[model samples]
Target: MARAQRPGSPPPGGLSVQDQAPGDRRRDSWKDSWGPARARLTDLAEDYARLLASQDPAAAEATGLPSRTLLPDVGPEALAERNRVERRLHQLVRAVETPRSLTGNHGAKDDDARDSTPGDGDPWGRAPLAVRVLRAHLLERLGTSIDLIESADQGAELNILTSPFQGVRRRLITLPTDLPGSTSSVQDWADLVDRYRAAPRALTGIRDSLAVSAAQGVLPPRGQVEAVARQTDDLARILASQARGDLSGGGHAAPGGALGRDLQVAANDAAQAVSDLGRYLRGELAPLTPVREGVGPSRHACWVRRMLGTSIDTAEVYQWARQELVDVVAAQDALAAEVLGTGSRAGDLDAHLRADPSTGMSPEDFPRWAQGVADEAWDAVVGRLLDVPDGLGRPTVLLDTPGGGVHYEEPEPSRSLSGRVLRSFAVGDETVWPWAERTTVLHESVPGHHTHSGAQSLDPSLTLWQRYLGKVPGCNEGWALYAERLAIETGLLSKPADRFGWLAARRWRIVRVLVDLGVHSWLPVPAEIAALPGAGGGTQWDRPTVEAALRAHTVLGEGFLQFEVDKQLGWPAQGLAYMLGERVWLAGRERAQHRAEEVRKKLDLRAFHNRGIGLGSVGLDLLIRELG
Candidate 1:
């Protein structure tokens, strides 16, 4: 985690005041400069954070927020209260006016920047960059929450990932052990048992909400219901096994102890509740749910804005993604030709790569190997490609719970822990593919999520709400995708096999954009894409057709492919964020570079990266306005 110091620069811990940009220097005096308006915004943000924590326990735990509830209350009354609080917060934010002195307008004739704001007459439109960023974030996030509630999407949400069912299980499984402020004391163990005991009531609330949504003619897709039911069954088995002291692996208290016996009893009860929910999902909900997986254009549009923090023309973006996929596949084909001594399709190249002995590692060695890759990437990028703070140390690489997929988790808000890059593998799966994972290591660790998120965690300029709750998936995922491409452009993917792996992963994201749009927005599959081998005889996008397309274009296994498709279908507009976010990142960087050239000054990529990452998580529009 050690960072090398740059010549004539401040030490690695953080940037000195003199080294910061004029705007950043202004931000350093944020508390003193903004005065009353800043205080009001801070208060409002804190209020919203508390409200959010109450509504989503999983999010609360993830961000290290203190929560009285172990699980989210998803009943009708809770949903209504959540909506009311969001609306009230939104109104309060809208009413807060910024002081004109700190606005930094300087009477500039920047129409592009001006147009990005709410309007000329709006108080927030004339606010400082930081104030505007906060205001915009709150407005969009609150607006999205209100919209989801009013549209009934919030009530009817049953997804393969991120739904209440999964949230409850994930929280319980992690419990007091992994959370912030947890000492793993007897009280902590008792609290864990209490949470386990509360599982039925929380799950029952979820079940009731789903049933109510169904009665009101708002039901999730049958595919999602089935997928979640299967997941519930899996969770039931996991919990049941834990109750029997089979899977604890010394992570829990001694099985023979009183606390352990209490936990076992509670877990068994929780497992029975989960099993009941699964049965209800299969026997009751699935019969009434629609067979079509898409949430249709309206809901999809709302999710697009919510997830991306910007609006997109679905047809245009879909067409653009189609061409991007073509380009990526062509690049992969060329790489395959050079590496394998013959040109091959993407799927063929992936198969060959998977079959290569040198590409595989045993499961036991995977974490250590991944850590090495992450460490190497950290050493390669710091001070050269990015100005990483010394406090933002290298993330730990660990194996995650099965089926969680590879992802990066930020450090706790307390800063007592470093970030972690979790590599999820299927249960009993032996071989780990490292060739295709090198770029992913870069994407999840150095110069990617950990770098981006760790920077946010260490930034004193950011408010607690901004650091913890201000995530825009498009900005975050886009930056990670950009980081992956950055590694490729910098020759970090040194081996041909690794390069091909990067290309394949890139192609997979492109395919996601296509399928996400095609399914959710009901867009037609392009003629050329339909003509591809194994695309099946379908003019329209369906689960099978989408899966087939993924199979042909990427190297994901059948289980992962099914999971990915179900996830995309269940979580509309989410799959498109990675590439869409990357688009903004690249364009924003290019525009910054061009502006620097116009001013006859060389653009520093390191500084540009630092500034962008320092912005925490804002929308693409806000990102462009701030960076530009």
Candidate 2:
């Protein structure tokens, strides 16, 4: 039989299959088969079920995650199969429940709880496409199912004020299946509880403020409000359910059944409290207020700050980022002349980037153009770039406009629509900056998330949690930012303007770190710092000085400023990931590169990167050690 070409390989006319050697042909045949050459995919469905039964049987029953058998090995074939089953599982789960976190203890404490914060330029936060899809499944299956029933607070538009004592209840129980050797120390749980309790007063205050704003004509849409309430009710229920289940010793089979029962009651109590507050908003506060469309960034920031545990001074952080921006812009200016024809106007860069017409071009093409540039970058880096694995699959670039940013969804199981790189289209009228788009692709696709996540799946030795759970934002995103800079240093951005894009992206991260630290840490925002460049010259800001500082430093134009500020306001510590992740990544790389030099061997950049990613998603502190 005539040998075939790799499926993704540029086809016959341009790259002849017959001309290829036998070894290449053999590999291409495997790629062409559309199934992994090694594993028996048939066994995957059963193994997956076994794993789930061992880990979380109740969640398995609720979502059917345990029904499928996943292949045992961590080979490419096994991963491919795992991907397929996980995707189906996700679809089934999302159909049952939305993953949007409602305002409750857990959701309120974590800044990254919002649905919009996924893949926000962080490699770790960027769940593998399989994981992202599966997490949606996990959320739907293991998370709260509030949409099925109305929450008691569903119709209430009031902010319930409760005594701090009412919210200070505590319980300690050893959880069954806390993952073999899971180290959730008593102190950690105690700290989590303490943090949860510390915020009631602040949460109540923010709720009341938002209500006041709403009464004065500034409230989020009714649907959004109801959504928040439902989310809140659902989260409380989930927490309560988990607790109850732990007490019952149900193991994985009755996942969160105990929590469900406990939260069922908690939800009712909270609803009544909210309802009473709603009455106060409409009756006592309505007459004295001015109506508005939604709670703005200021109010949202307050809530986010209370949730995430942060202590960075926002004003100082903003000043630092702004200063860095000046330096970055200056550097870009020097490079622009050499790349964009020496005299290209400042306004021309965006248009120049969008003008590239390449092989994968589409009508008013967005991602294809970006992908082409990224492809060129990869070509430059391959072999010479780093130690890229031969088996790593080529990424599939797709538009995800209408969503905030690019997302790296790992491939589905069964290899159907696998490795689809979903790029959220410029949702709404958010203009796509050519440089921003390409940088995003590099970070989310190339030597960034796509590579990191793929490595995790391929590394069988990693624990399930490392492979799939607890992807705290800081390390993941930080690595991506580092990767972007690494690509630039490696001369991947041959085009000067592309280099500028990388720098711009870096500036974006600097901003995120400063702001994230500011909000969660309760640092003050300086008025002078607030007066720096941003929306309304920072006049629109009325947040804690720290939050205001972060916003002013990270965001530029009015709209971006507003969007990021609001995002940070609603979700704390999330912004910190971009900065913190990058910092750790940069420092670690520096250490690696320095150590490699003293050893007098050509440092394998690819191996270093793969190792970092292969360690799995871990806490930033652990990440530093893993890299070392």
Candidate 3:
């Protein structure tokens, strides 16, 4: 996120001469505010997180489990808990807002203060950067959670799989290893068995909630319902395997003989619960689901806000996607011409590249292949592109999910374990090894998620709230998307084919942004790009149209394409987060770099990168406000 022409590295902390100027108020107050500001932020972060976790157990798992508690009952009970938390958040936000005044200056006499005394409304902005950002974060958190809950329609995101249930299931299974505080393996197994035993009862609450939601006319799209069923069915199989003594399912080795015997039986019961839920989703829920592919304006707006943490005009976003696609096409062509030489058909390059044997590794071989790629990506950027901290990424684990793509889990802030990439290298996506795997690796692992996420977890200056809860999609996903460009910029995409992979990777993002805007807003697909997806132009933004358009522009296989499409249907504007986030990050970098001279300062890439990541996990709006 930062770059400079410094002769060598500046210091141990990466602070420069300009940063430590004798009278530099910015640096001084930045130091001064660290204590009180951090304390307040930590309190805010912990309270908000605990409250949220009370409602959504998975959120707690993702945050280092300060309280190693299983989520309370699901369904309406959990929804009620969330409502209480939401109200509490509003009160907290009001309580913590820095009133319009300043007291003692923060660092130096002329330094920009953190906040003015309680009532003095001097023109200079009140509140420290951290406090302002924290307040905004609390607000953003409430918006995403409460708005989704408030807008509980049949198509709302409170369903069994993609909405919140799947996440809860994942956290529950991973608890023994993921939770802090080490217990003996036998004790851990017993604790896990207890949770396993409790799973069925816990699920009844969720199953009942789903029934009530359906009764109230709150249903999801039929296709999404089916997609979620596929996911639930997949998870059930994994649990069943674990119950039968396949340790891979639970990430726990069997204790053997009598001690492990009951583990298997308990796991069997858990698997039965999971399977029963899957049955409900497929046999009971799908028929009741609506067949519509798009959300109405109100729901769409909520999704946009939910994912991006900012609002944009949907009509403008659609046109922008179209224009962005045209540019992407041109850039790809230019790169292709450079790769293939003059008069060589650019589209042929794609055809030739797709035919490569390496693109079709069998599903059994994908974990090793993906793990190898993760290793290569880490080594490539560890020192060159990022100063990666110790104990970040581990050998990738191809965790079997319901329907899976590449997803990264950062090491918990506890540092007790290494980060593992869950690549549910599902078999349907042609050969699971698509060309974009490298870029995706970079996006999900080193120099992208692995490094960026590690920074978020490891930064000492960040409050626990910011650490556990602050990661907005825009700030983090934006960095990962920007990482793809960085890989290309650094000449990592050496071959024309590799460069094409980069293009294809980004091409899908552009397509996603367009599809999200189109499906939700029903923006009229422009004629210039109507045929843009494939041979015949697209007329409307529907499942087939978006799928064809994606296939036309990207190297994604059929199964992968379908997975992405169905997710887009259920998840809505979340598809836009990657590219939109990358755009913000890219622009923020340029904005800072370009304005460096105006501020009589030189940009520090390491500091810029470090600070950008260190701001914990706030949304892009706060990121731009602070970093810009």
Candidate 4:
């Protein structure tokens, strides 16, 4: 049997070495132009990337790094080591002088702008755009990481989504067996077996950290603990079933063979480990966790910085969200009236659309329909709206596992694998809503994550850290939300039903701001919002009250709505990223437009988009400055 080719090997019929030489030379020239300070930053970024890859195996696999077989060691010793490495990296970053060409006469005067917060330092003192963005990115990112670790926030992070328990199992289940080849080799199976065998140790490390957190009174809420425990139990069952299936005939390895048996035994062991974790969480940890879901003000602020890469005044943001929610609901009501030719209630409009045979699709047709939408979006945007690199091809659309939710997975940094838009549906979810899904496809594929992430991966000017690790949710999710609105502006959502879908999506995000802030920061629910049916009469926000609010304002299915609520409760401040990020994007664009008009020039939308995305993922604060 032929051995699997390494990742990053040219795909069949892809560009040959000669064909790629010109682009390669161009990239080299770009790198050669960097000054010593920039060069030092790039070197540090590479070092950090390697360190992260060694510590985070799931991340390594996601980014096509070499260490895909290992799992993260989240024990106290490992956490301390990581903190030390981050501190040293931070020191080196601070010591590197700004290039004189980049830092004009401003002389790095510290300013207390919203972009610059305490301990984050300032990155906006007359430096060239590139220098300022890079410096700010490193400062904000490293600062946030160090803060989370030091504050014990890292140890207490258990959630429905993005927690270590879920991440380990998800990564294992989704591990790419056919990497660098069309079919798995025996070696590939062996590698997977190795990961399964290592699962117990990795999970033990996580449990140790969580135990420490519990002792320190830094535990996640009881709800999150319970949810994760249930999820772990489900995952254990899936793993066990998977093992038996593989041993019988479901996998590439021969039945009753040594490799097959090894896989079965390893997978069973991993399942048992997961089962043990579930029991521990439910029996020992849940009772100790706080009943109230909120993380309170101080921890909420830390999470805001971690998720958005900027600090926000929670009260101010909450007030803004209240008014924004009002405005969005008004707009949504008008759209509903236009779409249904009746009342302005969103539920009625959604019901009408869902009941319409023309608007519904069978589950079998969902992927193809979604794919067409993605392809059409590509054709509509490229060249006309934005300058897409020839190498950053269209993303593939597929149905993911049940309950996975809709998301975009970035391509392997090497570009050997294309990005994917995974659309998940709950079991028995047979009907697909095109009107709603069209905006989603546009957000996750064409002008959203795939476009942003693919461009970053393909850019030779980016450091490895920027390409693989520089994920600011504010910049990333904000751009996607902006893309949704852009689609409406550009006529992609021209149909009345589709346009209403956009409004529904917009309203959903706006509602998220209120719900996230209300629950996490303990903001009092506004009077008007509290009056809505199902929204319980209380100043405080709770799961039932928030669920009622989501029901009234958004068109999501029950399962997804519950999932979203749980996600917000468990992962504080993350749901705020969409609306808050969009706020910055819109403000940035308007500022650019105003400046262009002042110069008596029309702003070129294509260039504006390409240039902004070309900077790769940075904090919203850095994003606005860089765009200007």
Candidate 5:
């Protein structure tokens, strides 16, 4: 009875399993039984993911699970349940990831070596072999998530003005699909009111948590406090402005129907509650807020780890960002010279192009116009540049309310084929400069998010857990950032404005790295950076200083700058993910191209792109290793 080689053990050299041929069965007898081990681990990994989604109704809805209710129960008990589930999950993941101390023999005389059946079905035939590798990949991701469950947005549990709570109000507006006259809409309106009435108690829980966090010196920065409070006020104002209107932003002047009267009553209560919550944040939470911007080195690492799924030295990242900003600005200046004259600065160029009504899309009509931008960008890219095997589906574009940032929601493959991109026209009375809007559409939809994320969701080779939990923001958003540049590289940026958009977007992202690193790592601001923003040099990296720098360097509008500054302060490392993620992606891509050049092989960029997408948000390090 020969023993099996433990799974994941390296060969004679330090070569990985990925380096070996799939048919190489030169192992002990227990190697034959390793199939059961692989099956059991992946089987449980898929199950745990569904169980995790079941606890949070928002998550359940987002991932296409059965939601117990329309609105999630945001109570202390719910929080406790979340913590328990995460810890248990962490333990389970660790169990699979850790190498077994000894190998088992699966000989005919060793029937005792057979521990147990993984499940009733031998999904061996149905499930892809890559799932085993993906499960190991998910271990790192789940470990990071488990940490985030304990840390990161603990502030959300205490603060009602935070994005997640605001999302409750925003999601209600989108969820009820039927018209205002339909019974479904009437029920939806009633549910909105129930959640609104529940807001006070839910908010008080957060208020208490903030108080607790405040005592621990965990207060959010002054800018974040101001931003959320302002957004909360906006919510209240919108409700009040549309007081006679229905939940879907339409006026129902003469409100008298079956549940319409109750709907009106509920709407009134929810509106009042939202207003009260805003008042609470401004009045009660403001004084306790810290004026300081940095969250210190210790917590910053946690943020980076949780956000990127890897640990990194913030000091190194900050240094890299500082250098990249200079390079990006130089390229932007060159593009500005080509598009506008050599003498034309980005700011003046932006002003000139947007001067006419025909030059740019109005921020107000962005939701209506973005559909075509996405459709056109995809038509230009796929087969021409990259491949989309399953064909494209238009993203469900939604107008994001206050606090909801621009993002893509991967549709639950179970419910529908299409994913959604949330475009925030948070800019009030502003213009989305011609090229900038197109690049973002590419980033958030079409060749960017929908292409990168949608492909993974549709990939039959992936497991349910892989699609749901495997997203590393660095990988996903990095691809999106890369996709923006792909538009220009592929000659898709035919318009001068489109070229400007590429430079403008890249410059903004570079600045984001600078601002985020500066905010979180206490990086020493240089004279070059001070000149970059053209806001006059400043040592302190506060809201005013950062805003001035953005104005000086990037072509982003004042409204967006304000939003960007507030988000950077509130979210910290997250703002940096676009550029930083792109940095990793570029490194991996460069590695592939350089290797291909060395071999004198024509590197099919499309194949390299597909390989990364197929991995479904595996960590950058693992992705790189596999790429090699």
Candidate 6:
């Protein structure tokens, strides 16, 4: 979708500071050839966005869910086609908007630049003719595509055509803190307020639209509307509190700082845009819609293509997830039985996991303990397990006292390529230790997301687009889960407590599959499934009737259930990524393992992983070839 820009035009989004390679002259030729096609693709994306905005008015009203479209159920081919369309859109944008221009004045500047950034893997290349033709159709429809989401009078809809994706551009900057020398931070409560002010107003519209849709009965019940409203309110309050120095210490919005605050504003705008656009689905635009049981396979495929940046049959992925769960659970159960005793049933193992005294560590020393665990894990990887990249700078692990889980934020492109793995301090029980600490380190730091992801981004051979933008969910999360298993192979799970912890983590993923299947596919959601005997009812949860509530809204759960339900409910396809990605990783690992005849050969696991990742954000089909 490369467009003709006035020569020396600033990059879209005021991101002018990031270093970028000059556009190749040969690429310009390809851009010229693809220009018409790219425009058509943009139209398709706009149409698809409108469809999403208006998907479910009744449900939106009842649950207050953002007026977003769900990915349609479809076969693989259609999904891939949709991806092509989006890729074209991104390519056109990138060709016109240089990355070097993304550095300043993100407020309005970034919005203008979003359509110009080549992203989601639609990089300039010598593509096939089919892609060229598809691009042409997309360009042809680009101008009128927005009409798909609107009524005769310009109302928005709730299908895959309208709400959430309407105003989407890859990166939304709410606060200005992302700029170097900016003092506003997500960590600072005051900066949070500033960021909210700058956030996109879409969310507010989304909330308001749902409320209206609910009252009109075009959306779901009041409960659903309330649920969404509550979420929106929570986000608003969180920003307000942080800004006012109520929840955390409020800090001044430093000069050139407050990007995080700005990001919040963008988030809000995204919400409002969704709601405003959702009006099409429940109101004037409903009559002309195609008749089906919700969005049919074709539409779902379109949605998947748009969201994932590739066309993937979500139903197929779900089937794969289901099978993987069966296999993983079966294998783990057998292992657990063997470890506990030959006669031990799952219940017995559960009892052991619950009653094991070693699992309990005092929470008061939690920060020191958590930091120590991260340090220990880091020690093993640095100059030992794998060659830590010298250019990665000094990696740091921090404890997040609130969220009680670990995640890593890689260094900004302007900063060193290092990363930070953070474990939330919110959950204070020592009972989560041994496994929690080990898995957190494995997943968040060494040999997991941070280490692998950081290195790849820093690799000089990779293009700026590939380095920073090549994030494939399957590869990223799948590799991390595989890394956890690798930790076990390296005896990282040596102690019983450690093993128990690993099992607990594994259980969490398994539960995600079950919950997603239960909620989305209309399967049964148990009130209480297998639990450790003395684990103190680890988070009482309401289990919905999956079949009865199919395409219906379910209340949020707490604890493990909370993660499972909330994620599955809010973001489709995310819950399945863990196991689905692990499946792909395990296949690659087994292949690599088979190739290495000697123990020493198999020992170079890092090499195998690096090879797999070097392929860049490709589909599973491409990954299979790369792994081979």
Candidate RMSDs in order: 5.2, 19.6, 6.3, 7.3, 8.3, 13.8
Q: In candidate 5, what residue range of length 10 has the lowest lDDT sum?
A: 108-117
By lDDT, the best candidate is 1
TM-score against native, each model: 0.86, 0.50, 0.78, 0.86, 0.77, 0.56
How would you encode candidate 4's per-residue C-alpha lDDT over 371-468 as one tens digit per residue?
89888888888777786655678898987768737888877635477888888888888788888889989999988887887677766666778877
lDDT of 5 by residue, 437-541 (tens): 777777888779888877777665566667665567777888898887787787667687777777777777777777777777667666666655444366756
lDDT of 1: 0.78
Query: What digit string (tens of lDDT, one per residue) describes model 6 on residues 1-628?
Result: 1122322445444434343334433333333444454444444444444332334332332223344332221112322343455455545633442223223323222211222223334332123222322332233233122222121111212322123322221112233344335565445534333333323443444434433433433332222222343444444454444343333434334323454445445345544543443343345434433321122233333323323334455556546555655565565567667778676654466567668667656555555665666566667665555554456654566655465456787665554434777666445344554444677677777667766676665654333333443345656677778778877877766776576567656656755655554443433334333242222232222233322222121212245344433344433345555665677778866776775765456536656565565444444434553454
Model 2 agreement with the true structure over 16-93: per-residue lDDT tens digits? 678887655644443343222112221232344554443332324322454221111222233334445555544543
The 10-residue segment of model 3 with minimum total lDDT is 1-10
Candidate 4 CA-lDDT value:
0.77
Against the hidden true structure, what lDDT does model 5 obtain?
0.63
CA lDDT, every prediction? 0.78, 0.46, 0.66, 0.77, 0.63, 0.45
Model 5 earns a TM-score of 0.77
Where does model 5 exceed 4 Å of error?
A: 1-35, 68-70, 73-76, 97-129, 149-153, 156-162, 171-184, 233-285, 336-380, 389-433, 494-497, 530-538, 594-600
Q: For candidate 1, write residues 1-628 as lDDT tens digits.
A: 2221222445335878788777655543542344567568878988888887877776586556777677888877788888999999999988886565645553224221233444555545544445567777888888888998878888888897888888887766775556544546787778878888989988998898888878888888888999889888988998898788664544544335888899889989999999999999999999998787687888788888889888899988987998898798788878777766674665666778777676598867878998988888878888787876567788899887677378888775365778898888877677777777888888999879988877786666667788888788999999999998888777778788888878878888898898899888888877876876666467777777787778777666687877787888889888888999999999989988998999899988887887788777988877877666
Error of 6 at 304 (Å): 5.1
Name the Cα RMSD for model 1: 5.2
Residue 313 in model 3: lDDT: 77
Ranking 1 against 5 by TM-score, winner: 1
Could you arrange the candidates by lDDT from highest to lowest?
1, 4, 3, 5, 2, 6
Alpha carbon lDDT at 124, candidate 3: 28
Task: Report the C-alpha displacement of residue 125, candidate 2, in angstroms.
Answer: 28
